[model samples]
Target: MKTARRYLASEIYRTTIAVILVLLGLFIFFDMIDALDNLNEKFTFVSLLYVQALQIPNRLYDLLPICVLIGTVIALAGLAQRNELVILRVSGISSKRLLWMLWLITIPFMIFAAFVSEVVTPYTEKKTSEFTISALGKNSTKMDSGYWFREPVDDAHYRVINIRRLNSSTEIDTITIFEYNTQDNQLSSVTNAAKGILQHGELRLDNVTTRTLTSNLAQVLTNEQAPLESISSLKTQKTISFKTSLTSERLVATELQPDKMSTPDLLNYVQYLEENNLQANRHIVALWRKGSYPFTLLVMITLAAPIGFVQSRKGGVGAKIFLGILIGIIFFMANQLALNVGMLNNLPPWLTALLPNIIALILAFGALYLMERRSKPRNFIHAK
Candidate 1:
C-alpha cells in the first residue's frame, strides 16, 4: 500500500508541476502583454516585468485549483489507459482506497496554497500595487482637497466622512471632513488634512486647511483668486472628534479591502468589527473562503477519480481530460457564486466555503458508485 501510494504521489506531483509551469508561463505572457500599455520612461519594460514578477505568487494561488484538477486527472487517466487501474481494482483496490490516496497526495499542495494565501500573496500583491502607483509617478490621486461630510453637533454638526489612504503606520495618510450648521442646513466648513491619525475615536489632523464659503465670500474668492487661508490656530487644536460610530471597520471596508487582506489580517479585522458591533458579513465570508481554499486541491483531485473509471477502449484520454476541465470550471464558478450569496444573504460563512468541496465529493462518490454497480454483473476482475 505504501509503495503504491508513493508511486501515485510521485506521478501526480510531476504532472502538477508541469501543468503549473505551462499555466504560469501562459498567464505571465498575457500579463506582460497587458503591462505594455502602462510602460513609459520611468515605468520601463524591466520595471513592468518586475511588477509582473511580484504577481506570480498571486497568480499561482489563483491557478492552483485548475492545475490540480487537470494534473490529477491526467495522471490517473494515464494509469487507467495503461490498465494499471484495472489491475489495482482486480487486486481489491476500491474507489474508496483511491480516494484516500488522492487526498493524501494532495496534502502537500494544500500546504503550499495556504502558504501563498496567508503570507506570500498578500505581500506581493501590496508591493505590486504600490510599485505600480509609484512607478506611475505624480499622476495618482493625492487626497482630495475639496472633501467633506456632515459633522453632527448641537450647533455645528461634524462627521469624519472620508479617508483617502492609510499612507503609513503611526499616521493616516489623508482625510476629508464636513462640518454643517444644524440651524439652517447650511455648510459651515470643508476641511482637508494632508495627514491625520485616529486615536480613541477622534481624528487628530496635521497640516489642515479649512474653507468656509458663503455666497459673497465665494464670489470674492472666485474673482480675486486670492490665496486660500491655511487654517492654522491654537483654538482649533487641529483635532476633529470622529463619531464614536466610526472605527477601523470603515477603513478596513474601504481602503483596506478584503481581497487585499491576508488571512491573519482578515481574522483580526473580523474580530475588531464584532467587538465594535459592526456588520462583518463580507469579511467573515472572505476569511472562510481563504481558509478553505487550500483544501480545494483535495476536492479537485478527488473529482478526477471518477474519470479514471473510464477504460481506454470506451473513451479517449482526451475526453476524460476535457471532463476534468469542465468539472473544474464548474466548481470554480460555484465557489465564487457561493461566496457572493453568503455575503449578500448573510449566510453562514463556513457552510458557504465548504459547499463546493462537499458537493464535489458527493458527486465523485456517486459516479464511482454507479460505475462499480454497473460493472458488478460483468465480473471484469478476471476479464480485464
Candidate 2:
C-alpha cells in the first residue's frame, strides 16, 4: 500500500504541475496583450512585464484549486484508461486510503498558498500600486486632507472635500469639509474649521456642517460649523496630531485593504468591518476562499480518484475533463455570487465564504462514495 501510494502520489504531483504550467502560460499570454496598450510613457515594457509577472503569482493563487482539480482528474483518468487503477484496486488499495493520500498532497499546497498570501501578495500589490503611480509621475496619490471625492448621494451628487493636515508626529490636526451640490453641480456650501481628533477610542471628526439646499430655487437654508472649543466641553480628549515621519504601518491599519493584508490582519479587519456596518462578507469570503485553496486541491484529488477509476462511465476523457472545467467555473461563480448576496443581505461572514466549498465537497464525496460502492466485489462480506 505504501509503495502504491508513493507511485500514485508521484504521478499526481507531476500531472498537477504540468496542468499549472499550461494554465500559467495561457494567463501570461492574455495578460501580456493587455499590458501592451499601456507600454508607453510610465508603463515601459520592462516594468509592464515585471508587473505582469508579479500579477501572475496572485492569479495562480486564485486559480490553484481549479488547476489542482484539472490536473488530478486528468492524471486519474489516464490511470483508468490504462487499467492501472483496477490493478491497484486488486492490490488492497481501498477508496478511503486513496482519498487520504490525495488529502496529504493538498497539505503542502495549502502551506505554500498561506505563505504566498501572507508574505507575497501584499508586497506585490504594494509594488504594483507604486509602479502604477511612479510610472504616471505621481509623488503620492493618497488624499488624506485637502482631498475630495465626488459621488452621487441620495437625490443629488456631492463633491465632499476635506482640508486635512497632520502634525510632525503623524496626528490628525485640522480638517475642513466642503460639500458641493449637483442640482446645479455647483459649490453650494463650504464647512470649514473642522478637525479630526482621537476621542474615547474613536476617531472623531468635529466642526461638521451637514448642509444642503432646502429648495430647488438656488437657496442654502442651513450652513453650520462649530469650533473644537465648542465641542471640547463634551468630554476628556487627548489632542492628536499627525507627524510627517510616520510610516505606512504606523498611520494606516493594514486591514483597510483586506486582500493585501496578512491572515491575522485580514481576520482583524473582518472584525472591524463587521462592527462598522460595512460589507465584510465579501472580504471575509475572499480570505476564506484563499485559505481554502490547499484543501481544495486535496478535494480535487479525491474527486478525480473516483471519476478517473470508473472504467464504465459514459463520458470520454475529453468530456470528463470538460466536466471538471465546468465544475470549476460553477464553483467560481457560486463563490462570487454568495459573496455578493451575503454582503447585500448581511449574512454571516464565514458562511458566505464556506458556501461553495461545502457544496463542492458534498458533490465530490457523494460521487466518490457511489463509485466505491459499485467497485466493491460481489463475493465480499462485511467484516462486522
Candidate 3:
C-alpha cells in the first residue's frame, strides 16, 4: 500500500513537472522574440540572442510559481481521474494526510524556486545588464551623475560619491566625493574628479579637487584638486561602486530578495539595507513570495484534482485549467497591485507580497474542503 501510494505520487509529480516545463519553454520562446523586437534598436541578431539567452533564468524565475500551480493541478487531476487518491483514502490516508503528502512533494520544488530566485535570477539579471550594455557599446552600470550614495561614520564624518556611469564590465566614470562634518553640520571637504576607477579592492580618481572647511562657523574654506588619489585606505570597498556596494547581499546576510538577487549578493545587500535605514519593504516581500510560492503550486494542483475527476461535459479539464490560468492571472494582478500600493503607501512589503498567496490559499483550501465534504464518500472517491 505504501509502495502504491509512493508510485502514485511520483507519477503525478513527474507529469506535473513535464507540463510545467513545456509551458515554461513556450513562454520563454515567445517572450524572447518579443524582447528582441524591442532590442532591435540597440542590438544585432547575435548580441540580442546572447542577451536574451542569459535572461532565461530571470524569465523562469518569474514563471515558476504559476508553473507550479498549473503542473500540480494537471497531475493531481489525472490521479483523481484514475481513482488513485480514492485508493489512498481507502488505505487509510486522511484528506489532511493527503494534503500534507502533496505539500511534501511540493517542498523540493519550492526550494528549487527559492534557489533560482536567490542564485540564478540575480546572476542572470546582472549578466543580462552587462551584455546589454556591451552590445550597446557602453561600459558601467553607473546611471547619470552615475551612482550617488552616502555613508556615515561616528555622526561626525561621512562620505558621498557621485559617479557618471558604470560600464558593462565593472568600470566606473565621472567620480565626485564629498566629506561632511555631521557635528558641525557643514560640508568639510569636496573632491571632484574627471573619472573614478575601481579594481582589485582599490579606487583611483583622476583630475581630483579637494576642498577643506576650517571653522565650525564656516569662515575658512580651502580647495585643491589632485589629478589622482588611491582611496584604498578608507577600509570600505563599497564606497567605490554603489551597485556592488548597495547590492542586496551587503544589506543582509541571507538570500533576502531571492527573486531579485543572487544568493551571495542578496545576503550582503540585506545587511547594507538594514544598516542604512533604507526601506527594504519591496525586497522583503519578494523574500516572502519565494517562501509562499510553493503553496501556490499546490493550490494549482488541488484545483486540478476536481476538474480531472469530473468527466468532461462540453467544457472539460482543459476549460477548468483555463479557468485556473485566469485565476493565476487575477492573482498576479492583485499581487502586483498590492506591491505598487505598498510602495506608494509605505505599507509593509512583506504583507503586500504575501497578499496574493494568502487570498489564493484561502480560496483553494475552502473550495477543496467544501467540495469534498458536500459529496458523499463513495461519490467523492469513485467516478460516476
Candidate 4:
C-alpha cells in the first residue's frame, strides 16, 4: 500500500510538471516573438526578457486547471495500461481507496497554488505593468499630496494628473492636474478636482477650484529639460481640459484590470467604486474568481479520479485521454462563460465564481458512484 501510494504521487507530480513546462515554453516563445515585433525606443532585449519573465506566473495561473486535468488523467491511464492498478485492486485496494490516494496527491499542489496566486502572481503582475508603463514614456513626480504622472501631449505641453484613489470607470477620486509649459519650463496653472470623470471622450472635473500661478511662473522656469513644477503649495481647483491621449477606456484598463490586481486590492477597489456609486460587478466577479483558484484545483482532483479510471470499461488509452481533454475544455469554457455572464448581467459574483467547480464535483461523485456499482463485487466464496 505504501509503495503504491508513493508511485501514484510520483507519477502525478512528474506528469504535471512536464505538461506545465511544455505549455510554458510554447507560450514564452510566442510571447517573446510578439514583444520583439512591438519593440520600441525604451525596451532593450534584456528589459524585454525581464518583462516576459514577470509574465510567467500569470500564465501559469491561467494554465493550471487544464494542466491538472490532463496530467492526472494521463498519469492514471498510464497506471491502468501497465496493469499496476489491476494489481492494486487484486491486493484489496477498493475504488474508494484509489480515490483517496488521488485526493492526497493533489493536496501539496493545492497549498502551493494558494500561495502563488495570492502573493507571487500579484507581485509579478505589478512589476510587469510598471515596466510596461515606464517603457511607454511616462515620468512620476512626488508631492506632499499624492503624486501624478506626466503624460506628454507634444513637445511643448504635458498634463500632470494626480490620482489619490480610483473609484470606478465613472469617477476618479482626489484627482489634481497641473498643465505645464514644457518649452518655457514653467507652471501654466493649477487645477484640483475632488473627482474627475470622462464624458464623451472628454474629462469633466467636479468640486473644482482654480488658482492662477502665472504671477510667479517665471521664477519656476529655471531649466528647459528639468520641468518639475511644485503645485502642492497651490490650494485651488481649476477647470482645465487639455485633451490627453488617455481616454476613459484606456484609463480604466490601466488601473482597474482585476486580473492584474491582487484579491484584496480588487475587493478594496470594488468597495471604493460602490461608495462612489459606480458599477463594480465585474470587479467583484474577478475578486471571487481569483479567490476560487485553489478550490478549483482541488475540485479538479476529484474530477480526474472517476474520468481517468472510467476507461476500464471503455476502449483504449487514447480514447480515455481524448475524453479527458474534451471534459477539461468544457469545464474551462463553462467557468469563463459564467463569469462573463455574471459581469454583464450583474448577477451574484461568488455564485458565478463557484458554479463550475460545484458542478464538476457533483458529476465526479456521481460517476465514481456508478463506477463502484458496476464493478465486480468484493465478496467471493473460496471453493477448495
Can you rank all candidates by TM-score, best first?
A: 1, 3, 2, 4
Winning candidate number (TM-score): 1
Cα TM-score of candidate 4:
0.69
lDDT of 3 by residue, 77-192 (tens): 56665666667777787666666666666777777876776677777776666565456644333333445566664557777766655544545566677777876667766666
**Over 4 Å off in model 4, which ranges?**
138-256, 311-315, 377-384
Which consecutive 10 residues in model 4 have the weakest lDDT in total?
138-147
How much is 274 displaced in model 3, in angstroms? 3.2
By lDDT, who's the top model here?
A: 4
TM-score for candidate 2, please give it: 0.70
CA deviation > 4 Å runs, candidate 3: 37-43, 79-94, 137-145, 153-155, 211-258, 294-315, 377-384
- Backbone clashes in candidate 4 total 5
Please write out the lDDT profile of model 1 over residues 1-384, one tens digit for every residue: 888889899888998899999999999999888878877798898897798889898889888898988998888888888888888877888878978888888889988888888888878866765565455632214344422222344544534456655543224566666655655655566677777876666667887777765444335556756646543222333555443434443343343447557977787767766754457788877777787787777778877877866677754889888888888889879988988887778788789788888898899878888877877778866476
lDDT of 2 by residue, 1-384 (tens): 778767777877788889888998999899898768877765688987888877876777778778878887787777777778778877777777778877776777778777877888767765665556446433223553333223333456443434344332123445544455666766554444456644334445555544433333223324253332321112222332321211333223321355555676566656655643445566676687667655666666666666666774444678778877887788778877987898888888777777777777888889888876765654365432
Over 4 Å off in model 2, which ranges? Answer: 137-257, 267-281, 312-315, 377-384
TM-score of 3: 0.75
For residue 102, model 2's alpha carbon misses the true position, in angstroms, by 1.4
After superposition of all CA atoms, the RMSD between model 1 and the true structure is: 6.8
Rank list by lDDT = 4, 1, 2, 3
